[model samples]
Target: MTCQRGWQLAVLMFFPLFLAACAQTPGKGGEVPSAPPPPTVDNAQSSGDEAACRLDDIQYAVGMPLGDPSSDALARQGGAEQVRVLRPGEAATMDHRPGRLNIHLDDNDVIEELRCG
Candidate 1:
């Protein structure tokens, strides 16, 4: 029938236009857009004398059990203004702080490593 032919012709004509509309246009100068840059560590706290945490002084705390008294002493020894204890499978912020001490503990709650953030 003519009506059926008209519908088929209309679909054939519009299908290419629909596909062209969905096609991604090249960016400026015909170059594809690049992915965003990876995040960089914030250095605002590590500038000059602002870094008060010293990991070398608190390395002895590694392999020890993290108790309340020991945690306070370790923070003092490391000259850290803040202390963060991270246990296995625990979520922690990625932000780095030069004056903060990060204590990583194993599944047994024993200190595995000590580092200055």
Candidate 2:
């Protein structure tokens, strides 16, 4: 009888402990590690670690300080706004490459003339 009682108590304790153990993924500073935000992203005030991102017209933040593509139709339609990721320590050689913003990305970065600049 005591053995049966012991087994029941053990089962209860074991389940909760197992679940708790599986609950949290760890990361630097115990900050509950999260995925690095998508390389391409958008923000409200046009700022942050985000790479060269589109910010209506003349105001945009290029985190790593680089140039990228902007949409033609978008520009023609007056949306002239879009941005692409330009990681840190990276650069792009852009020219009057027509409606498409032609930029040369670094080794890792690609020459993606994404509709988004």
Candidate 3:
């Protein structure tokens, strides 16, 4: 019984250290590098207002060729702050950035849905 209790105490003491070691940042000295700057699109347009990203403007794009859309195409079709094309099984964060458009595509590489986030 005493040996079992000592083993349990030892495990409790080392568990957090094990977790910390597992979570260490990769690269030199375990120091995490700063994140790179957000991507910049040359022709990305700014709608200025959250409501400015109207779904009706780009509704026609639903049946268009499926692929990553160019900033120019998005600007011409829908004047939004940002446009993201999501493919099937691809995970996207739930954060809703104003004036941002999310285009969801099916496995067949066809635009299936569009909405402003």
Candidate 4:
């Protein structure tokens, strides 16, 4: 009988320790640990100042000869945040970058369109 009582007391004392060992420790500062946010797509073409991009500021690039150094100079002088010249039928991603002036040219290398994207 004494042996059984001793075993019961031993188990009773160790049970609380077992439960303590199984419990999770609190996070730093005693705050509950939260799940990390889900992954999101990263848009490489997005400009930080999209609202400030004004297409009308770079309209002078239209009708200019493409591949001409003078056109790039003009775009730089026209307050364009960024300049991208694309040739006709050229493969390009549709991603728009704000604060940028995209100059589209035809097969003849003539500037066909100028816009901010």
Question: What clash count goes with each model?
Answer: 0, 4, 0, 1
Which of 3 and 4 is ahead in lDDT? 3
lDDT of 1 by residue, 15-110 (tens): 999999999888999999888999997765466655569888878778778884477789888898899989999999997777888889999889
Compared with the true structure, what per-residue lDDT tens digits does model 4 show for residues 78-111? 5566777788778877876665677788888888
- Tell me the spans in candidate 2 whose CA falls farther than 4 Å from its real position: 36-117
At residue 73, give the lDDT of candidate 1.
Answer: 89
Model 4, 116: alpha-carbon shift in Å? 1.1
Ranking by TM-score: 1, 3, 4, 2
Model 3: runs farther than 4 Å from truth?
A: 1-51, 67-71
What C-alpha lDDT values do all the predictions have?
0.85, 0.44, 0.75, 0.72
lDDT tens string, model 3, 1-117?
Answer: 999999999999999999998984867887687889999865344344454567887787786666455544764578677788888789899976667888778877778888888
Instruction: Give candidates' CA RMSD values in order.
Output: 4.5, 15.9, 12.6, 12.0
Once model 2 is optimally superposed onto the true structure by TM-score, how far is the C-alpha of residue 102 displaced, in angstroms? 34
Which 10 residues in a row give candidate 2 its minimum summed lDDT?
58-67
